[model samples]
Target: MLPSVTFLAKFSPAHRRTITASAIHLTPWQPSSPQAEHASLSMMADKCKSMDQLKQIHAQMIVTSRIHDTFAASRLLNFCALSASGDLNYALKLLEHTPMPNLFMWNTVIIAQASSSSPFEGLLLYADMRRRGVVPGKHTFPFVLKACSNMKSVRCCEQVHAHVFKFGLDSDLHVVSGLVRGYSVSGGIGDARRVFDELGNRNLSIWTTMICGCAQNDSAEEAIRLFDGMIADGFEPNEVILCSVLSACAQSACLVLGEQIHEYIEEKGMELDVILGTALVNMLLRTDHWLKQNSAFMD
Candidate 1:
């Protein structure tokens, strides 16, 4: 009988590791009906509410020799690596035990680890993937770059940026967006801008990324410039960004920048309504107040 969920939770890390290892290494066999069996087992794995339930399904797979199927192994791996109740250490163990892990499995583990408290683990997995000759698809770099973004590891980011070009994934919107964010976090606004400029098909997301990247790096002037360009490029400015750039402008306390926001709202006739009229009213009051302060200082 499997340990109760509460009992399993109470086990020491070492004991848990022992149990996970024993559960995964169940006597191996090649199932005669991997397709049907793995599919059904995968459904059971997906619906598992706790590790105990997952272990039961996993043991069933082993007994039926369905664990040899990559799809079946990956389902268990995905649940363990990603589910809220799942265990990452157990998932890593599963990755090793799988006879042949596929790109999806590798990516699933990488994605989970990249977003974990230890992002370097994700980077390590990426390096291991390269060592094993598992060619990364375009979807892979964004997650890899996400780790770099989390770590603020500019050098790692730059290395991954090189890999982006090497793999010809530089044009992937998500990849470049991640690159822009990674660069921005490390105060490499120029690198972010260069990446932003390199991409030809700039969606609102990419535009927002570059603009927010600028705004965050204290490059308010650049943010305002890009915001202008975003508007010129036929993209409507959303209120979140509108206020972000507006705050930067208000902080710079430059009347010209304040006027630019007003001009943008008035000129664009944007109907993506967001209580912007109140924002514009506040902008005018602040602009008036800013002018008063400067005028008094001149006196």
Candidate 2:
């Protein structure tokens, strides 16, 4: 009986290691011979894939006193809250119990809130971060601005803009791009353009944002004009830019311009890709008269 018990104990550790390694990366606590309760807690954390799994893990941890370890508990909270399939509530609960959460901990929760479908929570988290005297960093602004965009809260966006200026991050290309996109999404194309114009050196993403803003506002002519300017500026049109240009053509039924773009795509060897080819076909079909005339000319 003693030999069998020892064998089972040894087997449990190896089995847990195998399971953890297969599902997620192993943590240091995983290899230690925890008490039966701690061992079970580790096992629960290993198998957590959804909110329900996290809840089971939490219950097991509570029963096993494994929650006493702050680091392990914090990790559990992060995993449960931030995992693709984990529950937000579970993560929050873990955070609440954390004695003195670090910046990383705060950032993780803030990001999780920002990325949730209801972005208002992200804004709230930002407010909480501020109240706690945590200085917002470059990483924080994008997520905060994204939440403002999602909520279409222009006032909040303006407030965030002020924060960006205060942080001297207003000139950051990525932050500037986010501000442009946020303004555009909030139906303030003028504001977006204003931000774009202030950019020191515009990248393709900034140009794309402006183009998309024009297209969404039924200003395809403006988008096309901008596309021409971008090309003249010697910025090679990438796949995203090409897609945006094609969208503008489809909207305006500018078959002549669309054909020119199609030709460019062919020359660039992008026409061989099924996705772009399909988009080109759809654009041509939308202007069938022009396509037929072009085919006749070729024949």
Candidate 3:
């Protein structure tokens, strides 16, 4: 499960200062009691809001006997690889010594590599996984597809899409979303739209993805049309969707539409925080001259 915003808010200025001081004073290797070990692992998992904390936990784990604990070790490896600075080398070293890693273990490492600076390393690991005869699961394709998206390797994405169908993950939301995103990023909007259309029930995230794809492809008209469709379908627009719509309006210099959106935002009592406010200001500035000229002509 994803961490709640409120839970993440706990890592505020005071907490970060305290954690940093504690990390500096902490002894890397110390003999730990069972209760202490359990507490340490729990804290490591919970307070992993920064790379500093992650490193501190990793160092503590190495110093203590809990380093060999499979569950703790796997979680540590995952946090390190995925969230903690994308340190693939360190993650690989830790995983190499883990005894009889399960599919989750492989999936975690592969995902880390896929999202890492060296994405080709992920492809290499996938090849190695096939050679080791570990059959890939549904969970495996999303990360690989993500890598293909990042690489913009259309051929590679197509191959993965085919494999997803073979593995019966064609109906899986996550796998299908990844395929759509991959094709979209690889300049295959038609393919992406086809994949999106096939989904039995379109979720908000899927709609947002399609909107973003259209926007990125310079199809602002299509993006605006889709946004209208989303509203008609009764999906309340979130900040992300609003931002995309604002961007499309700004690009098209549609001052009337932009003002209408601003009014909608105001009516909904949406917070005009920094980002949204900035976009609004930019759009108004860009179109203000036209508004002024029209008013003068009318006068």
The C-alpha lDDT values of all candidates are: 0.77, 0.72, 0.73
* Clash count per candidate: 0, 0, 0
The count of backbone overlaps in candidate 1 is: 0
lDDT per residue (tens digit) for residues 77-167 in model 3: 7776777454666667767767656677778888887886777777777777777787788889888887888888878888888888887
Candidate 3 residue 276 C-alpha distance from true site, Å = 2.4
- Model 2 scores what on Cα lDDT? 0.72
The TM-scores of all predictions, comma-separated, are: 0.77, 0.72, 0.71
Give the per-residue Cα lDDT of candidate 1 at 24. Answer: 49
**Candidate number achieving the greatest lDDT relative to the actual structure:** 1
Clashing pairs in 3: none
In the range 16-108, model 2's lDDT, one tens digit per residue, is 445434444334244345665465565567567766555545543443456766655766767866888777876776777666666666767
Model 2: pairs clashing at backbone N, Cα or C within 3 Å:
none
Q: Which stretches of candidate 3 lie over 4 Å from their true place?
A: 1-72, 83-87, 253-255, 289-299
Q: What is the C-alpha RMSD of each candidate to the true structure, in Å?
A: 8.5, 7.6, 9.9
Which candidate, 1 or 3, would have the higher TM-score against the true structure? 1
Over the full model, what C-alpha lDDT does candidate 3 score relative to the true structure?
A: 0.73
Worst 10 residues of 1 by lDDT: 290-299
Better of 2 and 3 by TM-score: 2
Superposed on all Cα atoms, model 3 deviates from the true structure by an RMSD in Å of 9.9
Q: Which pairs in model 1 have colliding backbones? A: none
